[model samples]
Target: MPSAHRERRRVTWWVALPAALALMAVVLGLLLLVAWLRLLPDALDPFGTRTEDRTGPALLESIQDMSRYEAASGNFQVVVDLDKDAKFLPDAVRGSRTLFVGAGTVGAHVDLGGLGEDAVTVTEDRKSATVTLPRARLGRAALDADRSYAVAKERGLLDRLGDVFSDNPNDEREVHRLAVRHIEEAARESDLTDRAERNTRTMLENLIRSLGYERITVRFAPPSG
Candidate 1:
C-alpha cells in the first residue's frame, strides 16, 4: 500500500510541473510583449488604432442671387451687463445676471437691384454720364460666436435650481439679442454708411473710366420712408 501511494504522488508532481512551466512561459511572453510595445514607436505597432471619418454628407440649402454691393464692414466689440430679477422677490431668492463680451460685424451695402431705367443718364455724344444709386443701408449684425464669451455669471438659489432642471439651461439668446441691438445702434451712430457711399462712388467711377467715359457723376437717391 505504501509503494502504491508513492507512485501516485510522483504522477501528480509530474503533471503539476509541466502546468507550472507552461504558465511561467505564458507570463514571460506577455511581459516581453508589453515591454516591446512601450519601447517601440507607435507607427511600428501592429495593434495600433486607425482613425476614420464617418460623418454624413452635407445637404445644400436654397441659394439666392446677391444684388447688393457690400462696400464697408465694421467690426464691433461690446460689453453687456444684463440682469433679471423676479418681481416682489429678493435678489438672493430669484435673480440672475451675466457679464458678457460680444463681438460682431455690420456691413453697409448699396442696393443696385432697385435701380430704375432713368437711373443712368448719358449725353448724346456719350462722353459723360450720371448714375444714381440707392442710399447705402446697413445689413443685419453678424455675431461672432467664436470671439464672444461670458465674463461672469451670477444666479440666485432659485435660479440655480431652475437651471439644474431646465432643458436649455445655458441659453444666452436674450443676451445675444441685446448685444446685437447694441451693435446695430453703434453702427447707426457711426459713419459706416458714408464710407460705403464713398467706396461705391469710387468703384463706379473706375468702372466708367474704363469704359471711355471722360466724365462720370454718381449720385445717391434720397432715403425713402
Candidate 2:
C-alpha cells in the first residue's frame, strides 16, 4: 500500500508540471505580443482600420477659349468669423460660430479681344505709333483650398445633432463665398489694376520698339462709370 501511494503522487506531480509550464509559456507569449504592439507606430497598427477612395473617374466638361492676358496677380488672406443664432434661444441650444482662415488669389487682365480697328493710330510718316487699350479689370477670386481652412468651430447641441443627420454636414460653401467676396473687394480696392495696366504698357512698348518705331505712346481708356 505504501508503494502504490507513492506511485500515485509521482504521477500527479508529472501532470501538474506540464500544465504549469504551459500556463507560463502562454503568459510570456502574451507579454511579448503586447511589447511588440507598443513598439509599432500608430499608423502601422495591425488592428487599425483604413479608408479608401472609391470615387469614379472624372467626366469631360465643356471648354472655353480665352484671349485675355493675365498681367498681374495678387494674393490675399482674411479671417472670417461667422456666427448664427436662433432668435430667443440660448446659444447652447441653437447657435454656431466658426472662425475660418481664407487664402486666395486675384488676377488682373488686359482684354485684347475688345480692340477695334481704330484702337491704334500711327503717324503718316510711320515714325511713331499710339495705341489705345481698355483699362485692366480684376478677375474672379480663386480660393486656395489647400491654404484655406477653418480655424475653429463651435456648434450648439441641436446643431451638432443636425450634422449627424444631414447628408452634407458642416457645409463650407457659405464661408467660401464670403471669403471670395472679401478677397474680391480687397482686390478692387488695391492697385492691382494699375499694376496690370503698367505691365501691359511696358509689354506693348517693347513690342512696338522692336518694330523700329522710335516714339511709342500707350494710352488706356478711362474706366466707365
Q: Report lDDT per candidate.
A: 0.92, 0.91
lDDT of 1 by residue, 12-79 (tens): 99999999999999987875796566764667655556798999999989889999999999999999
TM-score for each of the candidates: 0.74, 0.79
Error of 2 at 12 (Å): 19
Worst 10 residues of 1 by lDDT: 39-48
| Tens-digit lDDT track of model 2 for 116-172 | 999999999887999999999999999999999999989899988988888554358
Pairs that collide in candidate 2 are none
Residue-level lDDT for 110 in candidate 2 = 96
Name the candidate that leads on lDDT. 1
